[model samples]
Target: MIWWAVLGAGLGCYLLKLAGLSVPPAVLAHPVVSRVADLVPVALLAALVTVQVLAAPEGGALALDARVAALAFAVGLLWLRAPFLVVVFGSAAFAALLRLL
Candidate 1:
């Protein structure tokens, strides 16, 4: 079952990519499509981060705690225009410290 799921997912992803490539270049080049495509990564990243922050460890109840603190710190760092590496490590360290307390 797991193998089937993995194969299906991989094939589906390839099909999606192929479909994207098969789209007419003119349509892809349209201003609205280009703007939306540009925002897709940002939207996806935000969703990913939100899920990670809100998900509970060990499949337990969802609740805010140290992870929220880390997310807050990361957001603050981003607001302050700190470098990407600093933002990531700082958030991780902050969360670890919170967890330890």
Candidate 2:
């Protein structure tokens, strides 16, 4: 039963993607649609990061801890145009140091 549901969901997602591809190019070329297409990935990534950093272990409440602070630090580095490697390692090291203290 679970496998069937999983297969059904996979098929549904494929069909949804196909539907998106089938949209007329004219529709996609619309100014609003084009702008939204550009912004959607950024919005989704931000939402994903926010949820991962703020969600509690039990998923029942928001959390504000070292993870959130580390995220802030990473954002600050990014604002300063830091390199990707530096941003990642700097954030990880900051989080570790926070947890230690």
Candidate 3:
């Protein structure tokens, strides 16, 4: 049952992406739409990260903890133009250290 639901959801997402790709080039070539398309990934990542950082699993309430400290390290590293691997590892290490303390 769960597998069926997962398969269906995956299929639905793929079809939606396929539909988006099927859009006419003329419509896609519009300047405003092109700008928006460029920003879509940024917006999606921000939304995904916001949810991950703020949302609680059990109650769906917003809570701050070691994750916030880890996120701070990530942001500072990003601002400093650190490499992606460094940012990721630095944040993970900071978060683990926070948890240990």
Candidate 4:
């Protein structure tokens, strides 16, 4: 069941990526489409961040925890224009300290 779910997700992602590449340059250059396209990455990143930071396992519940703090720190670093590697390492370090405490 898990394998099937993974395969389905991979296939869906591939299809979406292919869809982006398949669009003709002229179509992408259209003012409306271009504006929407520019927003796609930001929207996708927001969605991804939301899922990682907000979702919980089993039944739905809300809690303030170290993982959440780490996520917030990472987002702050991103807002400050920190390099990708620094954000990743800093988040990992923060999470580790939290876990140790």
Candidate 5:
């Protein structure tokens, strides 16, 4: 039963990709469409980060933990134009320090 669901999801994803490919180049080239395409990944990544930070590991309840503080630290670094490695490592260290306390 799980395998059937997995296969169905795989097929659905393939169909969705095919549908995206079927869109006309003209539509894809429109200013609004192009801007949306560029921003979609950013929006998706923000949503992913939000879910990871706020969602509890074992249940549906929202969590407030060291991860939130670490995320804020990372955002501050980004606002300061810190390099990518600094942002990643700084956030990890901040989170580790918070957890260790």
Candidate 6:
């Protein structure tokens, strides 16, 4: 069952990648499609981050943690227009220190 799950996941990923390559540039460049496509990655990343930072092991409810703190700091830095790398490393360091404490 686990192997089947893994295989299915792999195939799904491959199909998505294949679709990415197979989709014509013209179709992607259409105004409406382009806007949606541009937002898709950000939306997906937001969902992924939300899950990683908020989801609990037993699936009861979201809880705060050092990682969430780091994410908040990172968002603040971005709001302040800090450089990208600075925001990333600053958040990572903050999370590490928080974890240590």
Residues 14-38, candidate 3: write the lDDT tens digits: 9999999999999999999999999
Model 1 steric clash pairs: none
Q: Per-residue alpha-carbon lDDT of model 1 for 1-101, expressed as tens digits? A: 99999999999999999999999999998999999999999999999988888888777778799989999999999999999999999999999999999
Against the true structure, candidate 6 has what lDDT? 0.93
Worst 10 residues of 2 by lDDT: 56-65
Query: What are the root-mean-square deviations of the candidates from the true structure over C-alphas?
Result: 1.2, 1.2, 1.8, 3.2, 0.9, 2.2
State how far residue 12 of model 5 sits from its true place (Å): 1.0
Lowest summed lDDT over 10 consecutive residues: which window, candidate 3? 54-63
Quality of model 3 by C-alpha lDDT: 0.94
Question: Which runs of model 2 end up more than 4 angstroms from their true locations?
Answer: none
Q: What is the lDDT of residue 97 in candidate 4?
A: 98
Report the lDDT of model 6 for residue 60. Answer: 82
Report lDDT (Cα) of residue 67, candidate 4: 77
The TM-scores of all predictions, comma-separated, are 0.92, 0.91, 0.84, 0.68, 0.95, 0.77
State, as a TM-score between 0 and 1, how close model 6 is to the true structure.
Answer: 0.77
The candidate, 1 or 3, that scores higher on TM-score is 1
Indicate the worst ten consecutive residues by lDDT in candidate 5.
52-61
- Using TM-score as the measure, the top candidate is 5
User: For model 6, how many clashes?
Assistant: 0
Off by over 4 Å in 1: none
Comparing 1 with 3 on lDDT, the higher-scoring candidate is 1
Estimate every model's Cα lDDT from 0 to 1.
0.95, 0.98, 0.94, 0.88, 0.98, 0.93
What is candidate 4's lDDT per residue for 27-66, written digit by digit as tens?
Answer: 9789999899789999999889777676676548765577
TM-score-based ranking: 5, 1, 2, 3, 6, 4
Give lDDT tens digits, candidate 2, residues 1-101. Answer: 99999999999999999999999999999999999999999999999999999999888989999999999999999999999999999999999999999
